[model samples]
Target: METLPKEQLLNSLEHLVDGHLQQAIRHFQNMTAHDLLQPAYNGGWSIAQCLDHLNSYGHYYLPKIQQGIAKNIHLPPKDTFKSSWLGAYFIKMMDPETGKKKYKAFKGHIPAPDLDAYAVVAEFIQQQENLLIYLKEARSTDLNAIRIPISIARFITLKLGDVFQFVIAHNERHIRQAMRNVTDINKRILH
Candidate 1:
């Protein structure tokens, strides 16, 4: 992973987090419960399902991040983060902008099809807010020095910076999926 100035990196991350928060709020603001729960097509996930999937990820990653930050609280902050090669690969793979291959959710991360749409949206927004807090905590630590375990394998870990990047990118991907689902539902309803 290439080195980036700390301030620049933090700013970028803040932008990403804030964008998620804003987009989520706007997307769900006026949506009816029916719209939120409606699937795009037969056997497809609803907006609630997309949010639930992201929430499942948050349930795993947020705690790991918090623990890592607490453990590394005494360490001095660094000016740049050197991302792990593996972590970088994961982030690249998950980034929606890359138009890379889609991945199936691990069994544990898959959300139930039946979920309350409002509750799912609320949980997702809360998780995003929590992520913003973690990002702030990260500003005072060496992002590269702190290693967080992957949800898939507790034995393997990635640098904190890479984990954050991966989480943000993943969120963006799913959020976009949820938006697309909403659009498709609306189109079908109109016709």
Candidate 2:
């Protein structure tokens, strides 16, 4: 497959950040102040905590990506997605036409973030601002030069730009999940 254009990736990064903010803002807008603090489901994070996790992680990734860029370092293999034991069988099961599915259902919710919606949104937006600054200030060569890792059946490496493109697809994947969660949660409570 062809590598994604740099301009496209940067533009998309901007969109994902903005989209995250908008979705969270809109969700909260419809909710009462108290409902925002209620756990999302029986035990899952409330909507506010979800944003807090995203808020924490937005800046959290910077250290890794920055280290990779500055030292020409590649992160440990843990960052990658691994193919399963079914291997080629599952490969055949997937449609080669559509890109990989964005998110898989998982068993558990994480520890809730220790923040309110106001703090979380403020922090999340600032982290995005920092990301934009970093992206703009870094030379194209830096983005093109850094080696980042991913996996299929095994480890593979790509430039920083490619990694972010992959991450953009990943972002859309989770956004879909978040949207679904919001819808499902609202349905359960309101209906």
Candidate No. with top TM-score: 1
| Lowest summed lDDT window (length 10), candidate 1 | 37-46
Error of 2 at 105 (Å): 11
Residue 185: error of model 1 in Å? 3.0
TM-score of each: 0.94, 0.57
Estimate candidate 1's alpha-carbon lDDT, on a 0 to 1 scale.
0.87
Most lDDT-accurate candidate: 1
Q: After superposition on all CA atoms, how large is the RMSD of candidate 1?
A: 1.4
| Backbone clashes in model 1, listed as residue pairs | none
lDDT of each candidate versus the true structure: 0.87, 0.52
- TM-score for model 2? 0.57
Model 2 lDDT on a 0 to 1 scale: 0.52
lDDT of 2 by residue, 126-170 (tens): 655666665554433446556555333225555565555444444
In model 2, the worst 10-residue window by lDDT is 75-84
